[model samples]
Target: MVLDAIYRGELLPCENNMEGNGRHKQAGKEIEQLLKDLRNNLSEEDMALVDQMLEQTLIICDTECSDAFQYGFSAGLLLMQEVQEILRKRVDTAAHGVF
Candidate 1:
């Protein structure tokens, strides 16, 4: 997937988000670091799960969103879902480890 290539540092994100609004000046570097950090912190199995979730979420966006506005909303929802799921699992893990 192009997204996976971008995630894996095989591609850059829009040449530093040069043509986009509300994008960081160093968005590409930021994403690269973000992926690196994630790899460092998450186990290989968990990382694969996260990657699968991301792909599934974007697949939903491809089918469900008809316009840029809707696509943005879909993507945002996917992000929220990803964050919430990760946090929920973290909480569950910590809770279990404490007992």
Candidate 2:
């Protein structure tokens, strides 16, 4: 199943397809401003260290977002399965003329 493929890490999530709302844009702007401040105030060596730190943070965030997406997708599939089971039960009951 496609879900199994995803769970097995065979299918990769597309990060580019993820869209954000106004709050995301605002937060990005805030981060940009902070980075700008750091660039202006910190020494070259310190800025290099900050850049490395940011690179690591980006990796962590990317991993977290991917995991969250997979988890939500799995949850959605389970919900759909539950709905289908409920509908099947209803159909069965109706066929038997049961209330």
Candidate 3:
């Protein structure tokens, strides 16, 4: 999910170079770090899925021509939500021994 979000965030809708500078770059870097952390912690299978998602998302993001920042922000939030959901589910399952 983090990977997907990063890819989505990276892709821009415009040819403007400004869209890829400063704030957007910082956000992309942050997202990349989070994705790395997630990769380190998840199971191999999960990681593989995430990798695939990330690849697809990145392709989309690359071509996106408008609202790159907004898309990036949204992707970051979604990544956060995905991580939270994963952790919550893991904890809940561990506590209850059921899904």
Which candidate wins on lDDT?
2
Could you give the candidate ranking by TM-score, starting with the highest?
A: 2, 3, 1
Superposed Cα deviation of residue 90, candidate 1 (Å): 66
Task: Tell me the lDDT of model 3 at 52.
Answer: 98
Candidate 1, residue 50: Cα displacement in angstroms equals 0.6
- Candidate 2 differs from the real structure by a C-alpha RMSD in angstroms, to one decimal, of 4.7
lDDT of 3 at 44: 90
Query: After TM-score superposition, what is the CA distance of residue 54 in candidate 1 from its true location, in Å?
Result: 0.8
* Backbone clash pairs in model 3 (N, Cα, C under 3 Å; residues 3+ apart or in different chains), count: 8
* TM-score attained by model 3: 0.43
> What tens digits encode model 3's per-residue C-alpha lDDT throughout 1-99?
757856789643354566648998898899999899998899999999999998999888766634666788799999999999999999999999886
lDDT of 3 at 16: 51
How well does model 2 score by local distance difference test? 0.89
Q: Write the per-residue lDDT of candidate 2 for residues 2-76, one digit (tens) a residue.
A: 889879986665643536667777998999999999999999999999999999999998899889988998999
Model 3 spans with C-alpha error above 4 angstroms: 1-20, 66-99
Q: What is the lDDT ranking, best to worst? A: 2, 3, 1
After TM-score superposition, the amount by which residue 45's alpha carbon in candidate 1 deviates from its true location, in angstroms, is 0.4
Give the winner by TM-score. Answer: 2
lDDT (C-alpha) at residue 76 in model 2: 96
